[model samples]
Target: MSPDLWSFALAVYARPDVEAACLRLQSAGANVCLMLCGLWLEQRDATCDDRRVHQLRQITDPWDRDVVQPLRALRLQWKEAADTDPLLKGMREQIKGMELEAERALLSRLEGMAQGWARNSKESSDWLEALAGEAANLNRDALRVLRVAAAGA
Candidate 1:
Protein backbone atom coordinates (compact mmCIF):
# COMPACT_ATOMS: atom_id res chain seq x y z
CA MET A 1 0.00 0.00 0.00
CA SER A 2 1.18 3.52 -0.75
CA PRO A 3 1.90 6.03 1.99
CA ASP A 4 -1.02 8.07 0.70
CA LEU A 5 -3.42 5.15 0.81
CA TRP A 6 -5.29 6.79 3.65
CA SER A 7 -5.44 9.98 1.64
CA PHE A 8 -6.87 8.03 -1.24
CA ALA A 9 -9.41 6.42 1.07
CA LEU A 10 -10.38 9.76 2.60
CA ALA A 11 -11.02 11.19 -0.83
CA VAL A 12 -13.73 8.65 -1.40
CA TYR A 13 -15.09 8.94 2.12
CA ALA A 14 -16.00 12.59 1.59
CA ARG A 15 -18.98 11.87 -0.57
CA PRO A 16 -22.30 11.73 1.28
CA ASP A 17 -23.81 9.17 -1.08
CA VAL A 18 -20.63 7.16 -1.07
CA GLU A 19 -20.47 7.20 2.70
CA ALA A 20 -24.09 6.18 2.99
CA ALA A 21 -23.62 3.37 0.48
CA CYS A 22 -20.53 2.18 2.30
CA LEU A 23 -22.45 2.08 5.59
CA ARG A 24 -25.06 -0.02 3.86
CA LEU A 25 -22.35 -2.35 2.59
CA GLN A 26 -20.82 -2.53 6.03
CA SER A 27 -24.23 -3.37 7.44
CA ALA A 28 -24.43 -6.16 4.87
CA GLY A 29 -21.10 -7.73 5.92
CA ALA A 30 -18.62 -6.04 3.56
CA ASN A 31 -15.38 -4.59 4.80
CA VAL A 32 -15.28 -0.80 4.59
CA CYS A 33 -11.98 -0.39 2.72
CA LEU A 34 -12.78 -3.21 0.39
CA MET A 35 -16.15 -1.67 -0.38
CA LEU A 36 -14.72 1.81 -0.96
CA CYS A 37 -11.77 0.40 -2.84
CA GLY A 38 -14.10 -1.54 -5.06
CA LEU A 39 -15.81 1.68 -5.96
CA TRP A 40 -12.50 3.46 -6.42
CA LEU A 41 -11.07 0.77 -8.62
CA GLU A 42 -14.28 0.58 -10.54
CA GLN A 43 -14.16 4.32 -11.14
CA ARG A 44 -10.57 4.21 -12.30
CA ASP A 45 -11.00 1.05 -14.38
CA ALA A 46 -8.36 -0.62 -12.28
CA THR A 47 -8.31 -3.91 -10.42
CA CYS A 48 -9.83 -4.23 -6.98
CA ASP A 49 -8.73 -6.21 -3.96
CA ASP A 50 -10.04 -9.30 -5.66
CA ARG A 51 -10.58 -11.68 -2.77
CA ARG A 52 -12.48 -9.25 -0.57
CA VAL A 53 -14.19 -7.53 -3.45
CA HIS A 54 -15.11 -10.89 -4.97
CA GLN A 55 -16.67 -12.07 -1.76
CA LEU A 56 -18.82 -8.96 -1.66
CA ARG A 57 -19.70 -9.35 -5.32
CA GLN A 58 -20.87 -12.91 -4.67
CA ILE A 59 -23.30 -12.08 -1.90
CA THR A 60 -26.55 -13.88 -2.70
CA ASP A 61 -28.83 -12.54 -0.04
CA PRO A 62 -31.50 -10.45 -1.70
CA TRP A 63 -31.63 -7.92 1.10
CA ASP A 64 -27.88 -7.54 1.13
CA ARG A 65 -27.70 -7.36 -2.65
CA ASP A 66 -30.45 -4.81 -2.72
CA VAL A 67 -28.67 -2.62 -0.21
CA VAL A 68 -25.48 -2.58 -2.27
CA GLN A 69 -27.13 -1.96 -5.60
CA PRO A 70 -27.82 1.61 -4.67
CA LEU A 71 -24.18 2.00 -3.79
CA ARG A 72 -23.10 0.60 -7.13
CA ALA A 73 -25.61 2.76 -8.93
CA LEU A 74 -24.59 5.85 -7.01
CA ARG A 75 -20.98 5.34 -8.02
CA LEU A 76 -22.00 5.15 -11.64
CA GLN A 77 -24.24 8.15 -11.39
CA TRP A 78 -21.56 10.22 -9.71
CA LYS A 79 -18.98 9.14 -12.20
CA GLU A 80 -21.23 10.02 -15.10
CA ALA A 81 -22.28 13.36 -13.74
CA ALA A 82 -18.70 14.09 -12.89
CA ASP A 83 -17.63 13.48 -16.46
CA THR A 84 -20.14 15.93 -17.89
CA ASP A 85 -21.12 18.91 -15.75
CA PRO A 86 -18.36 21.48 -15.55
CA LEU A 87 -19.80 23.29 -12.54
CA LEU A 88 -20.45 20.31 -10.28
CA LYS A 89 -17.77 18.09 -11.78
CA GLY A 90 -14.98 19.44 -9.62
CA MET A 91 -16.92 18.82 -6.45
CA ARG A 92 -17.82 15.34 -7.62
CA GLU A 93 -14.18 14.54 -8.18
CA GLN A 94 -13.31 15.98 -4.81
CA ILE A 95 -15.89 13.76 -3.14
CA LYS A 96 -14.60 10.66 -4.91
CA GLY A 97 -11.04 11.47 -3.94
CA MET A 98 -12.00 12.05 -0.31
CA GLU A 99 -13.89 8.79 -0.15
CA LEU A 100 -10.82 6.80 -1.20
CA GLU A 101 -8.49 8.69 1.11
CA ALA A 102 -10.80 8.30 4.09
CA GLU A 103 -11.09 4.57 3.56
CA ARG A 104 -7.33 4.25 3.24
CA ALA A 105 -6.71 6.35 6.32
CA LEU A 106 -9.21 4.53 8.52
CA LEU A 107 -8.43 1.05 7.18
CA SER A 108 -4.76 1.26 8.14
CA ARG A 109 -5.96 0.65 11.66
CA LEU A 110 -9.11 -1.36 11.03
CA GLU A 111 -7.87 -3.92 8.49
CA GLY A 112 -5.68 -5.57 11.05
CA MET A 113 -8.69 -6.08 13.26
CA ALA A 114 -10.69 -7.27 10.28
CA GLN A 115 -8.07 -9.83 9.21
CA GLY A 116 -7.98 -11.50 12.61
CA TRP A 117 -11.28 -13.26 12.05
CA ALA A 118 -12.09 -15.83 9.41
CA ARG A 119 -14.25 -14.70 6.53
CA ASN A 120 -17.03 -17.11 7.49
CA SER A 121 -16.42 -16.76 11.19
CA LYS A 122 -19.08 -15.92 13.72
CA GLU A 123 -17.46 -12.56 14.36
CA SER A 124 -19.77 -10.77 11.94
CA SER A 125 -22.02 -9.31 14.62
CA ASP A 126 -19.01 -7.92 16.40
CA TRP A 127 -17.56 -6.70 13.13
CA LEU A 128 -20.78 -4.87 12.43
CA GLU A 129 -20.53 -3.16 15.77
CA ALA A 130 -16.99 -2.09 15.05
CA LEU A 131 -18.03 -0.92 11.61
CA ALA A 132 -20.77 1.18 13.13
CA GLY A 133 -18.21 2.93 15.27
CA GLU A 134 -15.99 3.59 12.27
CA ALA A 135 -18.97 4.72 10.24
CA ALA A 136 -19.94 7.20 12.89
CA ASN A 137 -16.51 8.72 12.79
CA LEU A 138 -16.55 8.85 9.01
CA ASN A 139 -20.01 10.41 9.08
CA ARG A 140 -18.86 13.07 11.48
CA ASP A 141 -15.90 13.94 9.31
CA ALA A 142 -18.09 13.96 6.25
CA LEU A 143 -20.56 16.24 7.93
CA ARG A 144 -17.80 18.69 8.70
CA VAL A 145 -16.71 18.65 5.08
CA LEU A 146 -20.27 19.12 3.96
CA ARG A 147 -20.61 22.11 6.23
CA VAL A 148 -17.53 23.70 4.77
CA ALA A 149 -18.61 22.93 1.24
CA ALA A 150 -22.08 24.26 1.91
CA ALA A 151 -20.74 27.38 3.56
CA GLY A 152 -18.50 28.07 0.59
CA ALA A 153 -21.39 27.80 -1.82
Candidate 2:
Protein backbone atom coordinates (compact mmCIF):
# COMPACT_ATOMS: atom_id res chain seq x y z
CA MET A 1 0.00 0.00 0.00
CA SER A 2 1.11 3.54 -0.65
CA PRO A 3 2.29 5.50 2.37
CA ASP A 4 -0.19 7.96 3.79
CA LEU A 5 0.50 11.67 3.59
CA TRP A 6 0.54 12.32 7.33
CA SER A 7 3.05 9.59 8.01
CA PHE A 8 5.17 10.72 5.10
CA ALA A 9 5.07 14.28 6.36
CA LEU A 10 6.07 13.23 9.86
CA ALA A 11 9.02 11.26 8.55
CA VAL A 12 10.19 14.00 6.25
CA TYR A 13 9.81 16.74 8.81
CA ALA A 14 11.78 14.65 11.29
CA ARG A 15 14.79 14.60 9.04
CA PRO A 16 17.77 16.72 10.02
CA ASP A 17 17.48 20.35 8.91
CA VAL A 18 14.12 19.62 7.23
CA GLU A 19 12.00 21.46 9.78
CA ALA A 20 14.34 24.47 9.68
CA ALA A 21 14.36 24.36 5.90
CA CYS A 22 10.59 24.19 5.82
CA LEU A 23 10.30 27.10 8.25
CA ARG A 24 12.66 29.13 6.11
CA LEU A 25 10.61 28.35 3.03
CA GLN A 26 7.41 29.19 4.86
CA SER A 27 8.78 32.56 5.93
CA ALA A 28 9.57 33.25 2.28
CA GLY A 29 5.89 33.05 1.25
CA ALA A 30 5.89 29.39 0.32
CA ASN A 31 3.18 27.13 1.64
CA VAL A 32 4.76 24.46 3.84
CA CYS A 33 1.84 22.11 3.16
CA LEU A 34 2.52 22.34 -0.55
CA MET A 35 6.20 21.75 0.11
CA LEU A 36 5.36 18.61 2.10
CA CYS A 37 3.08 17.43 -0.69
CA GLY A 38 5.84 18.08 -3.18
CA LEU A 39 8.19 15.93 -1.12
CA TRP A 40 5.60 13.17 -0.85
CA LEU A 41 5.04 13.21 -4.61
CA GLU A 42 8.76 13.13 -5.16
CA GLN A 43 9.09 10.13 -2.89
CA ARG A 44 6.44 8.44 -5.00
CA ASP A 45 8.24 9.37 -8.21
CA ALA A 46 5.30 11.43 -9.47
CA THR A 47 5.74 14.08 -12.08
CA CYS A 48 6.42 17.56 -10.80
CA ASP A 49 5.76 20.51 -13.05
CA ASP A 50 4.33 24.01 -13.07
CA ARG A 51 0.82 22.75 -13.80
CA ARG A 52 1.00 20.25 -10.95
CA VAL A 53 2.31 22.90 -8.59
CA HIS A 54 -0.54 25.21 -9.59
CA GLN A 55 -3.02 22.44 -8.97
CA LEU A 56 -1.57 21.88 -5.50
CA ARG A 57 -1.82 25.58 -4.67
CA GLN A 58 -5.41 25.67 -5.80
CA ILE A 59 -6.20 22.70 -3.61
CA THR A 60 -4.51 24.02 -0.48
CA ASP A 61 -4.45 27.83 -0.56
CA PRO A 62 -7.98 28.27 0.76
CA TRP A 63 -7.59 25.85 3.63
CA ASP A 64 -4.29 27.34 4.65
CA ARG A 65 -5.60 30.87 4.53
CA ASP A 66 -8.85 30.05 6.27
CA VAL A 67 -8.12 27.33 8.80
CA VAL A 68 -4.46 26.65 9.47
CA GLN A 69 -3.22 30.20 9.52
CA PRO A 70 -5.89 31.34 11.93
CA LEU A 71 -5.16 28.53 14.35
CA ARG A 72 -1.47 29.25 14.14
CA ALA A 73 -1.98 32.95 14.66
CA LEU A 74 -4.18 32.32 17.65
CA ARG A 75 -1.66 29.95 19.16
CA LEU A 76 1.11 32.46 18.71
CA GLN A 77 -1.05 35.19 20.15
CA TRP A 78 -1.68 33.08 23.22
CA LYS A 79 1.95 32.12 23.67
CA GLU A 80 2.84 34.93 26.03
CA ALA A 81 -0.20 34.42 28.24
CA ALA A 82 0.09 30.67 28.08
CA ASP A 83 3.54 30.91 29.56
CA THR A 84 2.14 32.47 32.73
CA ASP A 85 -1.34 31.03 32.94
CA PRO A 86 -1.76 27.30 33.40
CA LEU A 87 -5.29 27.25 32.01
CA LEU A 88 -4.25 29.26 28.99
CA LYS A 89 -1.30 26.93 28.51
CA GLY A 90 -3.66 23.96 28.21
CA MET A 91 -5.87 25.89 25.84
CA ARG A 92 -2.90 26.80 23.74
CA GLU A 93 -1.86 23.19 23.56
CA GLN A 94 -5.34 22.29 22.38
CA ILE A 95 -5.12 24.96 19.73
CA LYS A 96 -1.78 23.56 18.67
CA GLY A 97 -3.34 20.11 18.27
CA MET A 98 -6.14 21.56 16.17
CA GLU A 99 -3.63 23.34 14.00
CA LEU A 100 -1.83 20.06 13.44
CA GLU A 101 -5.10 18.37 12.55
CA ALA A 102 -5.85 21.11 10.05
CA GLU A 103 -2.51 20.48 8.40
CA ARG A 104 -3.20 16.76 8.29
CA ALA A 105 -6.50 17.40 6.57
CA LEU A 106 -4.74 19.60 4.05
CA LEU A 107 -2.19 16.90 3.38
CA SER A 108 -4.93 14.34 2.85
CA ARG A 109 -6.61 16.64 0.36
CA LEU A 110 -3.33 17.11 -1.44
CA GLU A 111 -2.79 13.36 -1.55
CA GLY A 112 -6.26 12.92 -3.02
CA MET A 113 -5.58 15.54 -5.70
CA ALA A 114 -2.38 13.83 -6.76
CA GLN A 115 -3.88 10.32 -6.59
CA GLY A 116 -4.24 9.94 -10.34
CA TRP A 117 -1.03 11.60 -11.38
CA ALA A 118 1.22 9.35 -13.36
CA ARG A 119 4.49 8.40 -11.73
CA ASN A 120 7.70 9.21 -13.54
CA SER A 121 11.42 8.57 -13.20
CA LYS A 122 12.24 12.16 -12.43
CA GLU A 123 14.73 12.86 -9.68
CA SER A 124 13.35 14.13 -6.38
CA SER A 125 15.41 17.28 -6.85
CA ASP A 126 13.13 18.21 -9.72
CA TRP A 127 10.12 18.13 -7.40
CA LEU A 128 11.82 20.51 -4.97
CA GLU A 129 12.53 22.88 -7.84
CA ALA A 130 8.91 22.80 -8.96
CA LEU A 131 7.67 23.65 -5.49
CA ALA A 132 10.38 26.23 -4.92
CA GLY A 133 9.24 28.04 -8.06
CA GLU A 134 6.20 29.26 -6.12
CA ALA A 135 8.39 31.01 -3.54
CA ALA A 136 9.77 34.30 -4.82
CA ASN A 137 12.19 34.84 -1.94
CA LEU A 138 13.71 31.46 -1.13
CA ASN A 139 17.46 32.06 -1.25
CA ARG A 140 20.08 29.88 -2.89
CA ASP A 141 21.48 28.60 0.41
CA ALA A 142 18.04 27.67 1.71
CA LEU A 143 17.16 25.98 -1.55
CA ARG A 144 20.42 24.08 -1.47
CA VAL A 145 19.74 22.86 2.06
CA LEU A 146 16.18 21.86 1.19
CA ARG A 147 17.32 20.07 -1.95
CA VAL A 148 20.03 18.19 -0.12
CA ALA A 149 17.73 17.11 2.67
CA ALA A 150 15.04 16.08 0.17
CA ALA A 151 17.49 14.27 -2.06
CA GLY A 152 18.84 12.41 0.92
CA ALA A 153 15.32 11.32 1.76
Candidate 3:
Protein backbone atom coordinates (compact mmCIF):
# COMPACT_ATOMS: atom_id res chain seq x y z
CA MET A 1 0.00 0.00 0.00
CA SER A 2 1.13 3.54 -0.68
CA PRO A 3 1.86 5.76 2.30
CA ASP A 4 -1.29 7.83 1.82
CA LEU A 5 -3.51 4.82 1.44
CA TRP A 6 -1.91 3.07 4.38
CA SER A 7 -2.26 6.16 6.50
CA PHE A 8 -5.88 6.69 5.47
CA ALA A 9 -6.80 3.14 6.35
CA LEU A 10 -4.97 3.35 9.67
CA ALA A 11 -6.88 6.47 10.62
CA VAL A 12 -10.19 4.84 9.75
CA TYR A 13 -9.37 1.80 11.90
CA ALA A 14 -8.20 3.96 14.80
CA ARG A 15 -11.51 5.69 15.36
CA PRO A 16 -13.69 3.40 17.46
CA ASP A 17 -16.85 5.01 16.15
CA VAL A 18 -15.82 4.40 12.57
CA GLU A 19 -14.79 0.83 13.27
CA ALA A 20 -18.07 0.20 15.05
CA ALA A 21 -20.01 1.93 12.33
CA CYS A 22 -18.40 -0.25 9.67
CA LEU A 23 -19.20 -3.48 11.48
CA ARG A 24 -22.64 -2.30 12.45
CA LEU A 25 -23.35 -1.06 8.98
CA GLN A 26 -22.26 -4.38 7.58
CA SER A 27 -24.22 -6.38 10.10
CA ALA A 28 -27.30 -4.22 9.88
CA GLY A 29 -27.63 -5.42 6.31
CA ALA A 30 -26.66 -2.03 4.98
CA ASN A 31 -25.75 -1.98 1.33
CA VAL A 32 -21.99 -2.44 1.54
CA CYS A 33 -21.50 -2.76 -2.20
CA LEU A 34 -23.47 0.36 -2.92
CA MET A 35 -21.90 2.32 -0.11
CA LEU A 36 -18.37 1.35 -0.96
CA CYS A 37 -19.12 1.58 -4.64
CA GLY A 38 -20.39 5.10 -4.14
CA LEU A 39 -17.35 6.04 -2.13
CA TRP A 40 -15.01 4.64 -4.73
CA LEU A 41 -16.80 6.53 -7.44
CA GLU A 42 -16.73 9.73 -5.45
CA GLN A 43 -13.04 9.41 -4.66
CA ARG A 44 -11.83 8.31 -8.03
CA ASP A 45 -10.40 11.73 -8.73
CA ALA A 46 -7.87 11.37 -5.92
CA THR A 47 -7.06 7.65 -6.25
CA CYS A 48 -4.28 5.88 -8.06
CA ASP A 49 -2.00 2.86 -7.83
CA ASP A 50 -2.48 1.65 -4.26
CA ARG A 51 -2.84 -1.52 -2.21
CA ARG A 52 -6.03 -0.43 -0.49
CA VAL A 53 -7.93 -0.53 -3.74
CA HIS A 54 -7.24 -4.22 -4.13
CA GLN A 55 -8.50 -5.19 -0.68
CA LEU A 56 -11.57 -3.02 -1.21
CA ARG A 57 -12.39 -4.99 -4.34
CA GLN A 58 -11.91 -8.29 -2.52
CA ILE A 59 -14.42 -7.24 0.11
CA THR A 60 -17.00 -6.19 -2.45
CA ASP A 61 -18.00 -9.78 -3.17
CA PRO A 62 -19.74 -10.17 0.16
CA TRP A 63 -21.65 -7.00 -0.70
CA ASP A 64 -22.49 -8.17 -4.22
CA ARG A 65 -23.59 -11.58 -3.01
CA ASP A 66 -25.36 -10.55 0.17
CA VAL A 67 -26.45 -6.91 -0.12
CA VAL A 68 -27.44 -5.93 -3.65
CA GLN A 69 -30.04 -8.65 -4.06
CA PRO A 70 -32.06 -7.43 -1.10
CA LEU A 71 -31.82 -3.81 -2.14
CA ARG A 72 -33.04 -4.67 -5.61
CA ALA A 73 -35.89 -6.60 -4.08
CA LEU A 74 -36.87 -3.64 -1.90
CA ARG A 75 -36.50 -1.20 -4.80
CA LEU A 76 -39.21 -3.10 -6.60
CA GLN A 77 -41.28 -3.66 -3.50
CA TRP A 78 -43.35 -0.47 -3.89
CA LYS A 79 -43.33 0.36 -7.53
CA GLU A 80 -46.78 1.89 -7.32
CA ALA A 81 -45.93 3.80 -4.18
CA ALA A 82 -42.68 4.99 -5.71
CA ASP A 83 -44.71 6.84 -8.29
CA THR A 84 -46.02 9.05 -5.53
CA ASP A 85 -42.63 9.61 -3.96
CA PRO A 86 -40.45 11.83 -6.06
CA LEU A 87 -37.45 11.03 -3.86
CA LEU A 88 -37.93 7.32 -4.45
CA LYS A 89 -38.44 7.88 -8.14
CA GLY A 90 -35.30 10.00 -8.36
CA MET A 91 -33.30 7.49 -6.36
CA ARG A 92 -34.47 4.68 -8.61
CA GLU A 93 -33.56 6.66 -11.66
CA GLN A 94 -30.14 7.48 -10.22
CA ILE A 95 -29.49 3.86 -9.40
CA LYS A 96 -30.43 2.86 -12.89
CA GLY A 97 -27.93 5.38 -14.25
CA MET A 98 -25.14 4.78 -11.76
CA GLU A 99 -21.81 5.25 -13.44
CA LEU A 100 -19.72 2.12 -13.83
CA GLU A 101 -16.44 3.99 -13.39
CA ALA A 102 -17.18 4.71 -9.76
CA GLU A 103 -17.83 1.05 -9.05
CA ARG A 104 -14.61 0.04 -10.78
CA ALA A 105 -12.58 2.72 -8.97
CA LEU A 106 -13.57 1.37 -5.55
CA LEU A 107 -12.88 -2.21 -6.53
CA SER A 108 -9.51 -1.15 -7.83
CA ARG A 109 -8.56 0.57 -4.59
CA LEU A 110 -9.35 -2.52 -2.54
CA GLU A 111 -7.50 -4.76 -4.94
CA GLY A 112 -4.45 -2.53 -4.97
CA MET A 113 -3.87 -2.73 -1.25
CA ALA A 114 -0.85 -4.70 -0.13
CA GLN A 115 -1.51 -7.84 1.87
CA GLY A 116 -0.39 -6.29 5.15
CA TRP A 117 -2.36 -3.13 4.61
CA ALA A 118 -5.48 -5.01 3.68
CA ARG A 119 -5.41 -7.05 6.89
CA ASN A 120 -4.52 -4.23 9.26
CA SER A 121 -7.40 -2.90 11.35
CA LYS A 122 -5.70 0.46 11.75
CA GLU A 123 -5.41 0.88 8.01
CA SER A 124 -9.01 -0.03 7.50
CA SER A 125 -9.94 2.62 10.06
CA ASP A 126 -8.19 5.28 8.08
CA TRP A 127 -10.04 4.39 4.95
CA LEU A 128 -13.26 4.38 6.90
CA GLU A 129 -12.50 7.88 8.13
CA ALA A 130 -12.19 9.11 4.62
CA LEU A 131 -15.42 7.40 3.70
CA ALA A 132 -17.19 8.77 6.74
CA GLY A 133 -15.98 12.28 6.07
CA GLU A 134 -17.31 12.11 2.57
CA ALA A 135 -20.62 10.81 3.86
CA ALA A 136 -20.82 13.62 6.36
CA ASN A 137 -20.22 16.20 3.70
CA LEU A 138 -22.92 14.69 1.58
CA ASN A 139 -25.32 14.73 4.51
CA ARG A 140 -24.60 18.39 5.10
CA ASP A 141 -25.32 19.22 1.52
CA ALA A 142 -28.51 17.18 1.55
CA LEU A 143 -29.57 18.92 4.73
CA ARG A 144 -28.96 22.30 3.21
CA VAL A 145 -31.11 21.36 0.29
CA LEU A 146 -33.79 20.04 2.61
CA ARG A 147 -33.75 23.24 4.61
CA VAL A 148 -34.15 25.31 1.51
CA ALA A 149 -37.00 23.16 0.36
CA ALA A 150 -38.67 23.36 3.75
CA ALA A 151 -38.33 27.13 3.86
CA GLY A 152 -40.02 27.33 0.49
CA ALA A 153 -37.80 30.24 -0.46
Candidate 4:
Protein backbone atom coordinates (compact mmCIF):
# COMPACT_ATOMS: atom_id res chain seq x y z
CA MET A 1 0.00 0.00 0.00
CA SER A 2 1.14 3.57 -0.64
CA PRO A 3 2.18 5.79 2.25
CA ASP A 4 0.10 8.77 1.17
CA LEU A 5 -3.70 8.73 1.35
CA TRP A 6 -4.20 9.66 -2.31
CA SER A 7 -1.92 6.93 -3.59
CA PHE A 8 -3.35 4.46 -1.11
CA ALA A 9 -6.87 5.27 -2.30
CA LEU A 10 -5.85 4.91 -5.94
CA ALA A 11 -4.26 1.54 -5.26
CA VAL A 12 -7.28 0.24 -3.38
CA TYR A 13 -9.63 1.66 -6.00
CA ALA A 14 -7.74 -0.16 -8.74
CA ARG A 15 -8.40 -3.52 -7.11
CA PRO A 16 -11.03 -5.72 -8.74
CA ASP A 17 -14.63 -4.97 -7.75
CA VAL A 18 -13.41 -2.03 -5.68
CA GLU A 19 -14.76 0.70 -7.96
CA ALA A 20 -18.12 -0.99 -8.35
CA ALA A 21 -18.41 -1.55 -4.64
CA CYS A 22 -17.39 2.02 -3.86
CA LEU A 23 -20.03 3.30 -6.27
CA ARG A 24 -22.62 1.15 -4.52
CA LEU A 25 -21.60 2.52 -1.13
CA GLN A 26 -21.63 6.06 -2.51
CA SER A 27 -25.11 5.56 -3.89
CA ALA A 28 -26.13 4.33 -0.46
CA GLY A 29 -24.96 7.68 1.02
CA ALA A 30 -21.52 6.71 2.24
CA ASN A 31 -18.75 9.21 1.54
CA VAL A 32 -16.23 7.37 -0.65
CA CYS A 33 -13.46 9.64 0.64
CA LEU A 34 -14.31 8.83 4.23
CA MET A 35 -14.40 5.14 3.42
CA LEU A 36 -10.98 5.43 1.84
CA CYS A 37 -9.71 7.35 4.86
CA GLY A 38 -11.06 4.60 7.11
CA LEU A 39 -9.22 1.99 5.09
CA TRP A 40 -6.06 4.08 5.28
CA LEU A 41 -6.42 4.30 9.05
CA GLU A 42 -7.02 0.56 9.25
CA GLN A 43 -3.85 -0.05 7.29
CA ARG A 44 -1.94 2.24 9.64
CA ASP A 45 -3.31 0.34 12.64
CA ALA A 46 -4.73 3.56 14.07
CA THR A 47 -7.35 3.16 16.75
CA CYS A 48 -10.82 4.41 15.91
CA ASP A 49 -12.77 6.47 18.39
CA ASP A 50 -15.97 8.55 18.45
CA ARG A 51 -14.11 11.82 18.75
CA ARG A 52 -11.93 11.01 15.79
CA VAL A 53 -14.85 9.90 13.69
CA HIS A 54 -16.78 13.04 14.51
CA GLN A 55 -13.75 15.16 13.77
CA LEU A 56 -13.38 13.50 10.40
CA ARG A 57 -17.05 14.00 9.67
CA GLN A 58 -16.79 17.63 10.61
CA ILE A 59 -14.04 18.04 8.05
CA THR A 60 -15.81 15.95 5.39
CA ASP A 61 -19.51 16.77 5.38
CA PRO A 62 -19.53 20.43 4.38
CA TRP A 63 -16.69 20.21 1.88
CA ASP A 64 -18.33 17.27 0.16
CA ARG A 65 -21.70 19.04 0.09
CA ASP A 66 -20.46 22.46 -0.95
CA VAL A 67 -17.70 21.56 -3.35
CA VAL A 68 -17.80 18.01 -4.72
CA GLN A 69 -21.51 17.38 -4.95
CA PRO A 70 -22.29 20.37 -7.14
CA LEU A 71 -19.58 19.54 -9.63
CA ARG A 72 -20.73 15.91 -9.73
CA ALA A 73 -24.35 16.86 -10.13
CA LEU A 74 -23.53 19.14 -13.04
CA ARG A 75 -21.46 16.49 -14.74
CA LEU A 76 -24.08 13.79 -14.25
CA GLN A 77 -26.77 16.16 -15.44
CA TRP A 78 -24.96 16.49 -18.76
CA LYS A 79 -24.42 12.76 -19.25
CA GLU A 80 -27.05 11.96 -21.86
CA ALA A 81 -26.67 15.19 -23.80
CA ALA A 82 -22.93 14.85 -23.66
CA ASP A 83 -23.21 11.39 -25.16
CA THR A 84 -24.40 12.89 -28.44
CA ASP A 85 -22.82 16.33 -28.42
CA PRO A 86 -19.05 16.39 -28.65
CA LEU A 87 -18.81 19.92 -27.28
CA LEU A 88 -21.02 19.09 -24.32
CA LYS A 89 -19.03 15.93 -23.76
CA GLY A 90 -15.80 17.91 -23.51
CA MET A 91 -17.29 20.33 -21.00
CA ARG A 92 -18.76 17.47 -18.98
CA GLU A 93 -15.37 15.81 -18.92
CA GLN A 94 -13.90 18.99 -17.49
CA ILE A 95 -16.51 18.99 -14.77
CA LYS A 96 -15.62 15.37 -14.05
CA GLY A 97 -12.00 16.43 -13.67
CA MET A 98 -13.02 19.14 -11.26
CA GLU A 99 -15.00 16.62 -9.28
CA LEU A 100 -11.95 14.37 -9.04
CA GLU A 101 -9.82 17.33 -7.98
CA ALA A 102 -12.35 18.13 -5.30
CA GLU A 103 -12.23 14.58 -4.03
CA ARG A 104 -8.45 14.58 -4.07
CA ALA A 105 -8.49 17.80 -2.09
CA LEU A 106 -10.85 16.22 0.43
CA LEU A 107 -8.55 13.25 0.81
CA SER A 108 -5.63 15.60 1.44
CA ARG A 109 -7.59 17.36 4.14
CA LEU A 110 -8.50 14.03 5.72
CA GLU A 111 -4.88 12.96 5.64
CA GLY A 112 -3.76 16.17 7.31
CA MET A 113 -6.39 15.70 10.00
CA ALA A 114 -5.20 12.15 10.68
CA GLN A 115 -1.44 12.73 10.39
CA GLY A 116 -0.70 13.38 14.04
CA TRP A 117 -2.35 10.23 15.38
CA ALA A 118 -0.02 7.44 16.53
CA ARG A 119 -0.48 3.86 15.44
CA ASN A 120 -2.11 1.46 17.88
CA SER A 121 0.11 -0.97 19.80
CA LYS A 122 -2.44 -3.75 19.81
CA GLU A 123 -5.07 -4.90 17.30
CA SER A 124 -6.23 -2.71 14.43
CA SER A 125 -9.51 -0.89 14.68
CA ASP A 126 -12.33 -1.62 12.23
CA TRP A 127 -12.29 1.90 10.82
CA LEU A 128 -14.33 0.89 7.81
CA GLU A 129 -17.21 -0.47 9.88
CA ALA A 130 -17.01 2.36 12.39
CA LEU A 131 -16.86 4.99 9.69
CA ALA A 132 -19.57 3.43 7.61
CA GLY A 133 -21.96 3.07 10.55
CA GLU A 134 -25.48 2.06 9.37
CA ALA A 135 -24.40 2.46 5.77
CA ALA A 136 -22.21 -0.61 6.21
CA ASN A 137 -25.25 -2.55 7.42
CA LEU A 138 -27.11 -1.55 4.27
CA ASN A 139 -24.27 -2.40 1.91
CA ARG A 140 -22.53 -5.38 3.46
CA ASP A 141 -21.28 -6.86 0.19
CA ALA A 142 -20.01 -3.53 -1.04
CA LEU A 143 -18.30 -2.93 2.30
CA ARG A 144 -16.83 -6.43 2.13
CA VAL A 145 -15.43 -5.71 -1.32
CA LEU A 146 -13.77 -2.56 0.03
CA ARG A 147 -12.30 -4.47 2.98
CA VAL A 148 -10.93 -7.15 0.68
CA ALA A 149 -9.54 -4.55 -1.68
CA ALA A 150 -7.96 -2.57 1.14
CA ALA A 151 -6.36 -5.77 2.45
CA GLY A 152 -4.87 -6.41 -0.95
CA ALA A 153 -3.81 -2.80 -1.35
Among the numbered candidates, top lDDT falls to: 4
Displacement of the residue 95 alpha carbon in candidate 3, Å: 38
Q: What value of lDDT does candidate 2 attain over all alpha carbons?
A: 0.79
TM-scores, each model vs. reference: 0.31, 0.86, 0.27, 0.96
User: Model 4 over residues 18-111: C-alpha lDDT tens digits?
Assistant: 9999988888889999999999998888988888999999999999999999999999999999999999999999999999999999999999
Clashing pairs counted in every model: 25, 0, 34, 0
Worst 10 residues of 2 by lDDT: 121-130
Q: Is candidate 1 or candidate 4 better by TM-score?
A: 4
Ordered from best to worst TM-score, the candidate numbers read: 4, 2, 1, 3
Worst 10 residues of 4 by lDDT: 122-131
Error of 2 at 129 (Å): 2.5
Q: How far is candidate 2 from the true structure (C-alpha RMSD, Å)?
A: 2.5
Clashes of 2: 0
Candidate 3: residue 62 Cα off by (Å): 6.7
lDDT for predicted candidate 4 compared with the true structure: 0.92
Best by TM-score: 4
lDDT of 1 at 14: 63
